[model samples]
Target chain A: SQTIHQWPATLVQPVGSPLSLECTVEGTSNPNLYWYRQAAGRGLQLLFYSIGIDQISSEVPQNLSASRPQDRQFILSSKKLLLSDSGFYLCAWSVQSYTEAFFGQGTRLTVV
Target chain B: TQLLEQSPQFLSIQEGENLTVYCNSSSVFSSLQWYRQEPGEGPVLLVTVVTGGEVKKLKRLTFQFGDARKDSSLHITAAQPGDTGLYLCAGKNGSSNTGKLIFGQGTTLQVKP
Candidate 1:
C-alpha cells in the first residue's frame, strides 16, 4: 500500500518568514504529486502539480512555489509568508492521470 | 475555465433523515469523484462515477452521475452523525491527461445526533 507523509503537522510562522512543507510518498514511483490549499470554509484549491521531477505546473499566481526533488518527494516553499497564506495545505499523489488521488494528513499553517 | 457548482453549501439535518446534495457543471467530464473531509484532515475519496448515468451505492450513501456526464448527486439514506463532514465533487476534463481536476466549492453537512 502507498502512503503519503507530510510535516510539520501544524506550523506557526511569523509574517515574512520563510516556509517549507515537505511531502513524500512511499510504495510508489513516478507518481503524480499535487499541492493544494484549503482556506477556512472553502474548497481545496490546486496550487501546483508535477508530472515528473522538475516539472511543475502552477494553477494560480501566489506567494508559494513547489518542487519535486525526487520521484516521490515534493516540497512546497515560500520565500516570505503572508497573512493570507495561512491555511490547510495538502499533498496528494496519484498513480496516473484521471485516477483517484491519495492524500497525506496535511499541514495546518498559520501566519501571524 | 471550467467551474463546478455545488448546491446547499451548508446543510444541517437530524440523524436518520435523508438528504441529497447536487453538483452541477456546464462542461462535460471524463470522470467524476466524490470526497468527504473532516476537520484537520485531507479529503478522502468516497466514490468515483465514470460512465454517464452511473449509479453507485456505498453502504447507505448513493451517488449518481448525470446522463450527460456534466453533473452528479450524493444522496444519503438514514444519515448518521459520523457522516457529517464536507462533501466535495471533483471532475476530470474530457481533454486533459495530466490528471488535473476542477473542484466544486463543497457542501458542508452536519447530521445532528
Candidate 2:
C-alpha cells in the first residue's frame, strides 16, 4: 500500500519568514508527485508537479518554488512568506499521469 | 480564469433527497475525476470518467461524462448525512499528457438528517 506523509499538520509563520514544507512517499518508486494549495472550502490550485528528480513544472507564477531532490521526496519552499501564502497545502502521488492519486493528510499554514 | 465551472456552489438537502452536481468546461479532457473533501483534509477520489458519454455508478452515486468530453455530472440518490462534504471536479487536458490537472471551483453539499 502506498502512502504519503506531509509534516507539520499546522503552521503559523510571520510575514517575510522563510518556509519549507516537506512531503515523502512510501511503497512506491518514481511516482508522479504534485503540490496543491486550497483556499477555505474551495477547490485546489496546482502549484507544482514533478515527474522525476530535477524535473519540476510550475503551474502559476507565485511566491513559491518546488524541488524534487529524490525519487519519492518533494519539498516546497519560499524565501519570504506573504500573507497570501496561507492555505491548506496538499501532497499527492500517482502511478501515472492519468491515474488515481493518493493524497497526504495535508498541512494548514497560516501566515501572520 | 477557471477552466472548469461547477454549478450550485452550495447545496443543502434533506436525507433521502436526490441531487446532482454539474461540472462544465470549454476544453476537452482526456479524463475527468470527482473527489469529495472534508474540512481540514485532502480530497478523496470518488470516480474518474474517461470516455465520452461514459457513465459509472458507485453505490448510490452515479457519475456521467458529457458526450463531448468537456463536462461531467454526479448524481447521488437518497442522500445521507454522511454524504455532506465539498465536491470537486478536475480535468486532464486531452491535448497533452503532462498529467497536470485543472480543477473547478467546487460544490459544497450539505445533507441534513
Candidate 3:
C-alpha cells in the first residue's frame, strides 16, 4: 500500500523565523500532491497543490510557498513566518487531481 | 470560488444515538465525498456520492446526495464511540474534475460511551 510521509510532527517557531515542511510519498510515482491547513476544530483550507515535478499551484497567498523538486517529494517553505502562519499543516497525494487523496500524519506548527 | 457550508459545527451525543451531518451549497457539483478524521490523523475516505439524490450505505453509515447536486448528507445509525471524529465533505470544484477540491467547514462529532 502507498503511504504519505510528513516531518516535524510538532514545531514551535518564533515570529519572523523561517519555516520548512517536507512531504514525500513512497510506493507511488507521479502522484498529485497537495498542501492543506486547518485551524483547531475548524475546516481545512487549500494552500497549494502540485501535478508533477516543478509544478506547483497556490490557492491562498500567504507567508508560505511550495515546491516539488522530485516526482514524489514536496516541500513547503517560508522565509519569514507570521503569527497567522500557525496551524496544522497537512500534505496529501492522490492518483490524480480528481481522485481521493491520501494524507500524511500532518505537522503541528505553533508560532510565538 | 466554490464554498461548502456544513451545519452542526459540533455535536456531542451518547453512544447508540442516531445523528446526521449536512453539507449544503448553491453551486452544483459533479461529485461529493465523505471523510472522517481522528484527533491527530488525516481524513479517511468514507464514501463518495455521485449522481443526484444518490444514496449509498456502508454498514451503519448512510450517505446521500441532494437531487440538485448541490448538497449531501451523512446519517449514522446507532452511533458508537468509535465513530467519534471530524466529518468533512468535499467535492469537485467546477467543470474540471482534475483540480483541487473545495472542502466543507467540517462537523466535529463526539460520541461518548
Best by TM-score: 1
Tens digits of per-residue lDDT, candidate 1, A1-112, equal 8899999999999999999999999998899999999987668899999999999999999999999989999999999999999999999998867568888989999999
DockQ for each model:
0.76, 0.70, 0.67
**Model 2 lDDT tens row, B1-113:** 43999999999999999999999998888999999999988889999999999999999999999999999999999999999999999998876565778889899999999
In model 3, how well does chain A match by TM-score?
A: 0.97
Off by over 4 Å in 2: none
Flag the better candidate by DockQ, 2 or 3: 2
List where candidate 1 sits over 4 angstroms from the true fold: none
lDDT of 3 by residue, A1-112 (tens): 8988899899999999999999999998888899999988777898998888998988878889999999999999999999999999999888875658778998999999
Worst 10 residues of 3 chain B by lDDT: B92-101
> What DockQ does model 1 achieve?
0.76
The structural similarity of chain B in model 2 to the true chain B, as TM-score, is: 0.97
Clash-forming residue pairs, model 2: none
Reference contacts recovered by each candidate, as fractions? 0.66, 0.59, 0.59
**TM-score of each model, in listed order:** 0.98, 0.97, 0.96
| Reference-based TM-score, model 3 | 0.96
